[model samples]
Target: MTTPTDFLLWVRGPGFDIALVVFILGVIIRLLEVLVLGRKHDYSEPRGGELGPGLKTVVTRTLPETGSFKRAPFTVIGGYIWHIGFFISLFLFVPHIELINATLGLSWPGIASNLVDAVAAVTIVTLIAMLFSRLTHPVKRYLSGPEDYLTWLVTFLPMLTGYLAYHRMIDPYPLVLGLHILSVEVLMIVFPFTKLMHAFTFFIARWYNGAMSGRRGVQS
Candidate 1:
């Protein structure tokens, strides 16, 4: 049987290192495009206001009252939960935490293993629910593009494979581990080119909306 130490060594080797590099670079490039190219348009325009009106009102409104939260409550809630849960699982998973500790000399306190496992389970279920809602809800269905479906698959595969790998449900750790890594690698390579780009764009978009509303003296 391959020991955990051997598995860790594999993760620390060239394949994992290259995948990490690609993920980081992809995210950075995507963010630059969103910040630089996405800013060329005048977001103060009426059409732009439709994209995020509550953001526009941020300067005048208390943070809690941002209409964005109210306008599309379910979408916002689901999105937030999925993102937070995904990030927590990604960073807190034992192997990842160990890697960070080893490579960067940093470690975050983590929840108990069982609790963390529960959270991962919840995250996966919530994400699946969210994807289903997007497909079934008329308004969401109308708004979703092909890229949306693709993104869901790309994101789902990694979480699912990671869970399977961690649980060791099917013996042969190598196969499950390889699947998890492959899913992640695919996600990393495609990140900058898909709707997943929103992860980087959302903050910039919010700030732009806020600035525009402030400049126009309009209640956001």
Candidate 2:
């Protein structure tokens, strides 16, 4: 039988490498598809400039409009909490920072592990709540499909496994750690093909829409 050590080694080595390759290649191919499908040439005369409006929209779109917030207070607030908590847990954790530094030759100071733990716990709760909301809300439930739920599962697993690993809630440290790494690998592998691609494409889309509107002298 394979030992926990073996499982850990495989995940850290071959498993991570495979996931990384798929993540990179998939992202590149998808991005190329989008970029290659260049928009139709606009013959209309430009009233202003595309660059300024595009940049402005990119910044403004980070927050919901007042009307949107009023309409979906839980979504807007919960989304903010999830994003903030996820970022803090991902970036400010010491082990994650060290891993990033080793992999990418980038380094940054990390916050307290306890703080990261708190954030991770909050993020996990927020994700669960979001899933519940999606399941119950008429419009969201109507639009939901397999990919949406799969995306949520893949996204949730990494955090849940990582938290469990950190707390050593599972038996055998190596096994738990291996599971955490594998969960992250799963997340990476599915990211480019799923709704998670919005992490990258959302900004590009917002900019494109804003730029077109700006060219027409309309505030996006």
Candidate 3:
């Protein structure tokens, strides 16, 4: 029988290595594909500078208009809350910061662990609410597919497991920590191939849209 210690070792070592390789390769290949499938060259004369408008759009498009937010307050608010929570949980936690420093030789101070724990808890709750909304809202439910649920599952697991691990809620500490690490590895492996790729590509997409509009002398 594989003991919890054994599982922990596997996930912390070989599992992490495999996930890292897959994440790097998958992201690189996807980026290359996007680059190779470049947009058609425009021959039209430029009416204004493309750089300024492109950068401006990148900033502007980050938040929706007031009217749009008012119409979809739950989505807008929930989205921001979870997004910020995820960022803090991922980048501001001491253990995660240590991991990043070990991986990239970059180090930064992390916030209090209690604060991270609270954020993770809130993020999990927000995700649940989002899921409920998706399931109940007719238009959202109609538009959602297996991919949507799968992404949500993968995203939620890490937060849930990490919170459990940190609190030592499970009987076997190593087992819960191992599960948390494994869940994170699963997320990393799935990230490059799924909508999670938006973390990286959203900026590229926004920049492209802005640049095109700028070239046409219009706001994106």
Candidate 2 lDDT tens digits, 34-148: 9999989999899989999998999999989999899999999999999899889888999999999999999999999998998999999999999999999999999999999
Local accuracy of candidate 3 as per-residue lDDT tens digits, 1-220? 2899999999999999999999999999998999899988899998778888878877898888899899899999999999999999999999999988988999999999999999999999999999999999999999999989999999999999999999999969999999999999999999999999998888888888899888888878
How many clashes does the backbone of model 2 have? Answer: 0
Would you give me the overall lDDT of model 3? 0.93
lDDT of 2: 0.94
Of the two candidates 1 and 3, the one with more favorable TM-score, higher being better, is 3
Top model number, lDDT: 2
Candidate No. with top TM-score? 2
User: Local distance difference test, per candidate?
Assistant: 0.74, 0.94, 0.93
lDDT of 1 by residue, 14-88 (tens): 657777887788888768765666546654545334435545444333244457887877777777777778888
* Model 3: worst 10 consecutive residues (lDDT sum): 47-56
